[model samples]
Target: MFGLKDLIGLIISCFIILPVVTFIRETGYFIISGLLGAKNPRLTIGSGPRFFKFKFIDIRRYYHVYSWFSFDFIKAKSKFAYISIYAGPILINAAVALVINALLANDFFEDSKTFWNRFIFYVFYFVLFDAIPMKTVNGKPNNGMIIYELLRYGKRIDYNEDPIIPGTTEAEEEYQKEVEKMKEIKWKEVEEEETFYTDKKG
Candidate 1:
């Protein structure tokens, strides 16, 4: 689906995109980690030389603090927080896009196009991909849900929580019990198909 138009837009966007996203990511990590306190965090992106360096945070398991909350609450908070966190990156992108569109359309800032582009590029040099994945990864797969599973079922992982990832023997047994219990409750399906009468009716 990529064509000349897409390629052109990509090239143009690249002029404002690469550094903007990178910077936003790195700056975000630094700001969050700083707020949380202890060791400063640095994030890196792409396959090239490391731009931001990740350091071991000295804080004592602060990231796991959110586990105290319920699964529903955690999920809701994460989603809401993500939007707030990404606001800066979106704004930066919008601003750069507007500037580039204006320059390309009216040729008003022809002389400083290079200057604006360079400024945008350099400003984002500090931002990196690792910074952005902080909330996205939640440090581990189960994250806040793990605590809820433990509290509710007395196990770190619920039976159906992961259909693919196998649980311990006890959890498996518990899951089978849950399944059998659920099976006892009969559910009537909507009888739209009458298999026995269909052929005779025809």
Candidate 2:
């Protein structure tokens, strides 16, 4: 399906269509997350350190295609919360695609009809592809899988709560023990310093 023309169109569309898609999708996350009362909703358009940011809009935008948003789940544990936060982008992108398609059907931009149609196709394709229920190459769950899990389980599934390695509780216990040992040593040093100063004063 991807001929030379299609490949060139995809490359061009990345520059033209991707940023707008990212902006709308990520902004939807922020708006929906806030409306659902998620604490500290943040919208960042790319991973790693932010290359640019909007303090007023609270969006950190980067030059890459990857983007992310997060919030405290304290108040957003409900099914609707999951829908609002996770499905917001998918829904918004769908809406945008529909609007573009409507405009295309009407031949709204006669001079730029080809470009508009291509844009519409790209947007729709992105929405459908992203809505698939699968983990991405980066191992992050897509919106479809997220929503499906929330519906099935009645809450968000936290992968982080799972063990880093299967059947290896001993590693966790050892890590905890090391932390406690460090804390005890620090406390002992503090106590010794306090005793030395008190004795000198006396």
Candidate 3:
């Protein structure tokens, strides 16, 4: 039966654990792409308007929901390189979860064992979904599907024009446009509210 403890756990999982795991997952891509000489790489966390950007990391307002790593171009453009890039998140998450599990088995972090266990569970959960070949809700192929297609057909077979990893430059441009649009909408709302007050005063 669901109770207060369950509710608290759910809140922590959604707001804290999941976001940290997501950042780690994206870090896998950032690390692999950097090693392969991806130019101007950027890691954007969450969607919607930007909150703050420092160095190559952009944190959005909704920081706990979605994240992605992008680059302008890769110096090593090869099938093997692409495969390594896609496999990065899966391998990294699995490695982290395994290491934690081993530590737990050795009587480490016993005081915070519950938190660590939950963290490991979410890590493996990400690995399981990411390592399976399937199409995502947006009709884009997941990393596993991309890797499988690459291995089997020697290329991506998706009809989607958008690249799996978007270019950082293009993404930034799109983000700026979205911000401007949002600003315009906010101004319109303010103007409407002001007009309503002015008419009431008359």
The per-model lDDT (C-alpha) reads 0.39, 0.65, 0.93
lDDT tens readout by residue for model 1, 1-202: 9999777656655645544444444344344333433132323233222223234212122122111100111122343343333343334444555566667568767776765555455443322322232222423423234433434655533334442122234433554576566555423222334544676698
Q: At residue 183, what lDDT does model 2 achieve?
A: 86
- Tens digits of per-residue lDDT for model 2, 68-145: 565544365667766666777778888888987788788788888777777777667667766887776456667777
- Which consecutive 10 residues in model 3 have the weakest lDDT in total? 59-68
Please give the clash total of every predicted structure, in order. 3, 0, 0
- Candidate 2 stretches greater than 4 Å from native: 1-11, 46-52, 56-62, 156-202
Q: For candidate 3, write residues 86-142 as lDDT tens digits.
A: 999999999999999999999999999999999999999999899999999678999
Between the candidate structures 1 and 3, which one is better when assessed by lDDT?
A: 3
Candidate 3 ranges with C-alpha deviation above 4 Å: none
Clashing pairs for model 1 are 22-127, 23-127, 26-128
Model 1 worst lDDT window (10 residues)? 65-74
Give the TM-scores of the predictions, in the order they appear. Answer: 0.28, 0.64, 0.97
lDDT of model 1 at residue 14? Answer: 61
